[model samples]
Target chain A: MAEIIGGYFTSHVPAIGGAIQRGDQQTPYWKPFFDGFPRVHEWLAKTQPDVAVVFSNDHGLNFFLDKMPTFAVGAAAEYQNEDEGWGLPLYKPFKGHPELSWHVIEQLVADEFDPVTCQEMLVDHAISIPMELAYPSVAEWPVRLVPIGINTVQHPLPSAKRCLALGRSVHKALASWPGAERVVVIGTGGLSHQLDGERAGFMNPEYDRFCLDHLASDPDALTRQSIHEMVRLAGTQGVEVLNWIAARGALGPAAREIHRNYHLPISNTAAATVLLEPACGVWALRRRSPRP
Target chain B: MPTPPRPGARPEPIPGTTLFDGDAARKGYHLNAMCYSFNRKENREAFLADEEAYCRRFHLTAEQRRAVAKRDVLGMIAAGGNIYYLAKLAGIFGLNVQDVGAMQTGRTVEAFRQFLLDQAKGA
Candidate 1:
């Protein structure tokens, strides 16, 4: 039986990559936010997990309005990186653990989550940037990728509770798999930041802090809050808060915040990351060691 | 092996039926953006409650507003938003992405796949 070793929370901000690509972290706008993520940089260096279940939203690359899957799970052996002309460098295509992916799909569906299983999906910033951020260039990626897409591009994205429920289902899927393994489930996107419409470039660090605290301790409290208020505070695109639920939910009723960070660069996002370890089983070994 | 397309290949604009071609995409954007933006039962109800004000913000006509207010995403989209924006709108509205496609082209899988491929090519 496999155990849920831990979970990661991340913000998939394209602007961060843009700044990295420009190599201008020292610029007034980006310095503080980048400074906040040292623990993450240190953590990835230490306890690198075997597989990462990545949840992100598509930017009209793979699933468009024509045929959107509310929740798309990659059952394919591999996924192609569609060049959206982002000019962000690409690497060898990310490999998918179809065996594990298929098992999780089968179990999640059987668990009544109704996951949309696909033979293939393309890599977009939703999955791409997070991949770059997690498995940095200097280090080779040891973890197999399971790309789960949330329909954040459109309205009525899955509720935070639903994404959390999906996370619980993913945990169930992992628990029943008959294999030797460690797992890291990641929920990417949002903590009260919006980009688009008249309310563009919105950031609410206060709300973001509240969201992080709740994620570590009382997420259901945040889940019970009204969507209008979430939008009002987090921005309309802020509904991506649901993706955070998936990560929080995978942590389940028993998990601890190993480390957490939040920063709003006064740019395009309210960035944050929380590292969680399951309340039981080998958590001590998973505590992020000091960086080399 | 080719099958015939869906019963309604393309929506024929009805006088009062709305889902007009000229404003379909923008209407779709507004409709779906609202969906993704508001998910709570109350937020959804509030958006639906002040349909006219929201429509006015988007500058939609009474009929186009009605299409979305009625939850006719296919009709609202068929009127004229970019399919990508339409897809986003559909997601926000609590409608399944594929169902929105189905609603637009009558759910012929082949037709929907073609729509996706064509979109990829255009991009």
Candidate 2:
């Protein structure tokens, strides 16, 4: 059986990313956010995982309206985080585990997920931002990366269920990898937000709390809602929550909530992080009815 | 606006990486937002009239110019042209790259542009 080394959830907000890149992590405003993850930091210091499955949506960097791919996987040798200048010092590019990554890819294809495969892929701030948060120990991070790029911004965004299904499939793929050990799967995105137009700074703490509650109990249930409702209640950009579904689905029905944190920083958004640990077996998932 | 490359300019692969060459892919998420935004028939007239001016405004590089000139969709990406620019080229060539990414995970230039604008501000 595949041993899920727990899962992590976070956001790729550029402001937070900028703060880290500029080396201003010590700033008072950013302190609470960092402190909230003491358990997460401690876990990383202890496990020092060998691989991180980063699920991030791409910026317009590679996928635009003309040729956006919904689910593209990066099987590159190295992936770099762009320091969009807000002072996050540029870090060395993260190396990838192509062998294991490809194995998982082959398995997914066999399982019927038509994943977009790429050898040369450019990851924008969206992916990089989350990496900085989850693995600050870049110089010595034990994790090799497997990048899963999603298209969250363009039209025809994946349904929440689609994102969740992708996550579950990832688990199926990982279970069959040969000799690959010590892996962490991360789902990153939003609690609530609207980063565009006159409604740019919208926030919904109520919805954020409600969404987290639903995800912990039954992510599959949460995945059934439409993006329109999310935008109306949570804000247009709040649709980012769809990305989190991918993470939640991978945790499976038996996933136990380890740590959860949600906060509204800079007024326009609510950022949250959740951790899930898988235990027991597929038998539980097969026999279980989703809890609400 | 710069004239279209005269015939026979020997279209080269866009100067950077594709989804295949992970070793040297995009240097940064840095992109020209105007490219994708202006890549529509409605906006094509304005785009052509002020192409060079617009490229300069966005601080686009020479490589990007060649990518757009050749109408090399993949090259536009490999050569460092931003989605904003590539989208515009796609508009001209009648292709839609943003839809491609969307089919998988659902995305749009507006979301990307917003993210970058946020970075440009916070950075």
Candidate 3:
């Protein structure tokens, strides 16, 4: 069976792409944000995951309001990134794990979580920027990809509970897949920053830290708040933390924090990255126990 | 301590924020559709060549056209624009997030950048 290694949560601001394009990682304005990733790099080096299942929200690159899926999974042979009209350099296509994707799709349906399965998909900065941050300057990515998109753009979004359920279902699917691949689950976007309305520059470090702490120690506590409350506390766009919550859910009931970094104002957003390792024995034991 | 919110009650309005609910989606569909076209380089170039013509192709509302013409970020939002799509339109004019932030907040670009930096002190 495929082994689920852990979960990585990070922000996916498009400006990070431009900062990389202009070689600004060492500059003071960007150094703090860039500093968060080296430890992530070290962890990736140690774990050596063969596949990455990414949870991120689309920012008008792949799906628009025409037909938005609450949850979508990519089963394409290759996922491409294109110009989002933001002038970030296009990244090379990422190879996909179709067999695993189909397995996940099948499991999701069986688990009663219907997700749109796309044989062709275009990933925007949400996926591309994080991939660049993870495997910088790679001509070809090292790991096969699985892109899962959660709708955060429009209102009437799937509830926080629903997103968590989606992640748990994904965890179940990965555990049952008949493969030897080592998998790392990645959730991208938000620590809190709003970029629309008069609240264009909103950032709540208090809420961000609370979320980071709870995400690692008590993710269910984070979900107790309603979507409206989340938007209010985190900000309009900051609600992308739903992706992070879903990613954490994939780690199962218990996870140990490997490393975490949080910084303010990465292009009008609070930026953060966290590495979580599932507590293998505890999780396995809990799974074996009967439901309450 | 604040009182706990009633379940299913309408959330308190967030000041200076607008939720992109279904109403906004319906109102801004054409405008957002036009901005979405900017994802293609040719569409961006065409919009740049004749802003009026491009806006017409999408059948944007008069208010949306005015907002686009004035480069009013806040006005666009009021006209039902979602920031994600409006960002692409902003890109056509070489406006980064900071620029748009400054524009919406009525601050100079440098001031807005400083405000963002100031957020760290509280963190």
Best by TM-score: 3
Full ranking by DockQ: 3, 2, 1
In model 1, the runs with Cα more than 4 Å from the true position are A85-87, A281-292, B1-26, B29-123
Question: What would the TM-scores of all predictions be?
Answer: 0.68, 0.68, 0.95
Model 2 lDDT tens row, A1-292: 4346778888776567657657767677576566656778787677666788878776555565446677888898887654232223555577888876787678768767788997877666666667678777557446788888777665456778888888788877776565647778887777676543234344667777777887766787776666545556666557777777876666565677778876655324567777777755686555344547
Candidate 3, residue B11: how far the Cα is off, in Å: 1.9
Report the Cα lDDT for candidate 2: 0.62
lDDT of 3 at A24: 100
Residue A81 of candidate 1: its Cα lDDT?
Answer: 74
Q: Give the per-residue lDDT digits (tens) of candidate 1, residues B4-60.
A: 895434433222122222244344555444433342345445655785665676565
Clashing pairs in 3: none
Residue-level lDDT of model 3, residues A205-290, one tens digit each, is: 99998888888678888888888899999999999999999998887778889888888889999999899998756757766566
When 1 and 3 are scored with TM-score, the better candidate is: 3
Query: Compared with the true structure, what per-residue lDDT tens digits does model 2 show for residues B1-123?
Result: 999995423233322212212121243122345554452344556567887765666565577666556554444555544333344355454443333223212336456334323532331
**Which is superior by lDDT, 1 or 3?**
3
Q: Please say which candidate is ahead in lDDT: 1 or 2.
A: 1
Q: Measured with DockQ on alpha carbons, how good is candidate 2? A: 0.04
Using DockQ as the measure, the top candidate is 3
